[model samples]
Structure formats: structure tokens, C-alpha cells
Target: MKIKVLIADDHQLFREGIANLLFSAENIEVIAQAQDGADAIEKAKHFKPDVILLDIAMPVMNGIEATKKLK
Candidate 1:
């Protein structure tokens, strides 16, 4: 099965770049993208991706806090 992935970052270019890179991998799938930590949480709950890539610094909530909430 393909590994589902969720990417969360405040930078549009960075987020899209990562997503593009992940998409090149046959075993990985980019399921969703979030602009901030809060959006990441919401998408996580909905998509339930196998992996979540977060930016340490973001608006609304930081990666550390989002990781805690997700846990």
C-alpha cells in the first residue's frame, strides 16, 4: 500500500516543493497540504495520513504545539 502523507508549512514554495518531491516516490502519496499548524490538525483528523511533515515555525500554532495536539 502507498504511504499517505500530509505536509504542513507556512511557505507556499516550500510546501509545494516537498509535495512534488514526495510524489516522485512510488511508495509515497501526498494526501493533503496545510498552511499552518491549526490547519494541519484539521487535515490530519480528516485525512488521517500515515505521515505528517510540519514546519517548526508557523502562524496560528507552531509545529511543537501541533505535534502535541495531534498526539
Candidate 2:
């Protein structure tokens, strides 16, 4: 099965770029994208993606906090 992924980053260009890269991989599927930590949490809970690529510096809650919550 394809691996569903969620990418959370503050930069729009970077986030989109990563999504594009993952889109090229046949085994990877980007389920959602979040612009901030809080959004990441919301999306994670909803999507329950197999993997999450999160940025360290994000608005609202930051990556570390977001990861903790997800854990």
C-alpha cells in the first residue's frame, strides 16, 4: 500500500515543493499539508497519515510541540 504522508511547514513554497517531490514517488502519497503547528495537529487527527514531515520553526505551536501532541 502507498504510504500516506502529511507535511507541515510555515513556508508555502517549501511545503508545496516537498509535496511535489513526494508526488513523483510512486510509493508515497501526500494526504494533506498544514501551514502551522495547530493546523498540523488538526490535519493529523483527521488524516491519520502514516508519516508526517514537520518543520522545526512553525507558527501557532512549532514542530516539537506538534510532534509531542501527535505522539
Candidate 3:
């Protein structure tokens, strides 16, 4: 099965860099990206990615809070 991934980070460059790297992997796919914690949660709900890489701090909500809601 494909390894679906969602990137959640306040930094655009960091997110883009990781996304680019992941895109090179044949088995990995970046399904979506979010700039903040709330957005991340919303996208995660829609994307249902296998893994979500989130930064510790973000606007609207924090990664910890987002993770709680997701769990």
C-alpha cells in the first residue's frame, strides 16, 4: 500500500522541502499540506493520511492540541 503523508508546519520552506523529498520516494505520497494546526487537523480529517508530520507550535492551535483532536 502507498504511504500517505500530510505535512503540517508553520514554515512554508520547511514543508516544501520535506514534501519534495517525499515526492521522490516511490512508495510515499504527500496527500496534503497545512500551515497551521487547525488547518492541519481539517486536512487530516479529509485526507486520512497514514502519517502526519506536524510542527510543535503553530497558529490557531498547536500540534499537541491538533493531535488530541485527531486521536
Candidate 4:
């Protein structure tokens, strides 16, 4: 099965770029994109992705805080 992934970042270009890169891999799938940590948490719960690519500095909670909550 493909590895499901969620990408969270405040920069749209960076997010899409990463998604494109991941998409090139046959064993990976980009499941969702989140703009901030809170959104990442929500998407993580809903999507239950196998991997999450998060930006450390973001609005509405930041990556570290979100990672703790997700854990």
C-alpha cells in the first residue's frame, strides 16, 4: 500500500512543492494539506495519515505544539 501523508505549512508554494516531490514517489500519497498547526491536528485526526510534513514556525499553534498534541 502507498504511504499516506499530510503536509502542513504556511507557505503555499513550499507545501505544493513538497507535495509534488512526494507524488513522484510511487509508494507515497499526499492525503491532505494544512495551513497551520491547529489545522494540521484536525486533518491528522480526520485523515490519520502515516506521515506528516510540518513547518516548525506557523500561526495558530506551531509545529512543536501540534506534534505534542498529535502524539
* Cα lDDT listed for each candidate: 0.97, 0.95, 0.94, 0.97
Regions more than 4 Å wrong, model 2: none
Error of 3 at 4 (Å): 0.6
Query: Estimated TM-score per prediction?
Result: 0.98, 0.97, 0.94, 0.98
Ranking by lDDT: 1, 4, 2, 3
Tens-digit lDDT string for candidate 2 (1-71): 99999999999999999999999999999999999999999999999999999999998899999989988
Predicted candidate 4 versus true structure: per-residue lDDT over 1-71, tens digit per residue: 99999999999999999999998999999999999999999999999999999999999989999999999
Q: Cα RMSDs of all predictions?
A: 0.4, 0.5, 0.8, 0.4
So what's the TM-score on candidate 4? 0.98
Candidate 1 lDDT, 1-71, residue by residue in tens:
99999999999999999999988999999999999999999999999999999999999999999999999
- Error (Å) of candidate 4 at residue 2 is 0.4
Candidate 2 lands at a TM-score of 0.97
Model 3 lDDT per residue over 9-54, tens place: 9999999999999999999999999999899988998989999999
Error of 4 at 22 (Å): 0.6
Q: Which window of ten consecutive residues has the lowest lDDT sum in model 3?
A: 54-63
Poorly placed runs, candidate 1 (over 4 Å): none
Per-structure clash totals for the candidates: 0, 0, 0, 0
Clashes of 2: 0
